[model samples]
Target: MSQTLPDFDQITDTLRALGAESEAAENHGLLCAMLCTMEGVTADAWLDIALSGTGRDALAPEPPEALVTLFDETRRQFDSDEFDFHLLLPHDEAILAVRIEALGHWCQGFLAGLAVGGIQQPESLPGELPEIIQDMLEIARAEGYELEDDGEDEAAYAELVEYLRMGVLLFREEFRRQYAKAGEGSIH
Candidate 1:
């Protein structure tokens, strides 16, 4: 939703040109997760670090401006109240054309990003946060299911995507709450 985010192809190409190791969907998912975990970390800083780190330093050409613009748009979308956070997944047509395992990759990338962003589990999690994270980990390892022409598999996939979407929002809220608590205790 939210006025249609950038297409996966453009993102994939941009990341490829920058010599990023992860694919587009997973890479963006990782960024989103990092944003959630790092609290006040800026998008620009994350991009710089990700691009300049490891095998990416050999890339001669600078990344396209559009890539930065799209990333900023995604950050704005997450901060906006009108939109529900949707995972940067492949479009249905592409998914139907081939068994794209972008969802699992996205989850895997998200977990990696969270870890890299220095996410630390609280001694006690609030609400269903722990379960939600566990579920995402399981989903990261899930195999792609065939989409039956009858639409059953599609329907199931849609539900799973919805769950992923809601989980991200919940995770954001929980992280914020935990951060606020830490800030509060520090001042006391």
Candidate 2:
């Protein structure tokens, strides 16, 4: 029988990579635990297996005082300002859609970087991503009202686009409600 893996938190500190800031302390632990839960494997081992030898190393466990450090750094970056652009996205879907928009821009830049860097051999990127990723990408494109794919069936893509639009609208409302739940003087 196949054995279950262990869980672990997001501790990716490899080189100049800026890892995503996990939701909360509990989420941090849970993320780590979830990582380990699959096949009870280590983070390094999982990356090695899932990501084929990109030569990227597993992130080390963060120090206990990491939160404090982040807080201090964040405070300094903003200079105690009440400005935050997280308003338009209060829910997960909204956040994800925005992130996808950002990602699309980043991806275009990366593709350009590859050409500028004069890399002779093309590296395997976005390799073996699950079908769910494709679906999510399609969904995000739809959410942004983008329907520029000219190869596929137009009607079908339009339907999918509409569905994503509905989702985006609903998620926007849900996000606003969540911000409302946050109490008075909150950015919404």
Candidate 3:
């Protein structure tokens, strides 16, 4: 059965309590994306390293049990057929509450996760992933980027988020297909 997704506030609060700077939604997205690129490792294993500061020392902190459950639920949701994944962005009464900087942080965390998973080879990446990844790196560096309060800018931001969501799904499918073609076993 499909499980209820974790509440964003709860997850974010938990991350904050754990001294984590990355938002839960971005963290989950990054982890899932890395999982797609991995050859031999389960989500739990990756989470342990991620929480242990294996890849980046600045992000080191032991996540609370609730945060662990959040990660598990995120993995489960990605593996489900519903594909109802929602980006962990805040929406103002109508406008998206998340700033452009937050998206940058999400992308930053994602690249970090990818590096930790040993999927940083641009030559091995298929499709526009390389370009997107590069773009994400640049976006991660955008500190003072500002968005106009117009509806058009909001639309553009929404489109970008949607593109990222699809990118995650595409990477997952490509990796799974590659694994199948290899006729190898997953490290699950």
Tell me, by TM-score, which candidate is best: 1
Alpha-carbon runs more than 4 Å astray in model 2: 1-134, 138-152, 184-188
Total colliding residue pairs, candidate 1: 0
lDDT of 3 by residue, 1-188 (tens): 76765666787787676556567766765676566667555645656654553333344444466656766776666677777655555543434445565677678777777776567485558888788788778878866646677798777787888887777677667777878888763322
Candidate 1 segments whose C-alpha is farther than 4 A from its true place: 48-62, 97-100, 122-124, 144-147, 184-188
> How would you encode candidate 2's per-residue C-alpha lDDT over 89-169 as one tens digit per residue?
122233334434433332232222223223223332123222322443443344354444453434553354344334323
Q: Which prediction has more favorable TM-score, 1 or 2?
A: 1
Best-to-worst TM-score order:
1, 3, 2
Against the unseen true structure, what C-alpha lDDT does each candidate score? 0.69, 0.30, 0.66
lDDT of 1 at 183: 63
Query: Each candidate's root-mean-square deviation in Å?
Result: 3.6, 18.4, 4.4
Is candidate 1 or 3 superior in lDDT? 1
Judge candidate 2 against the unseen true structure and give its global Cα lDDT, from 0 to 1: 0.30
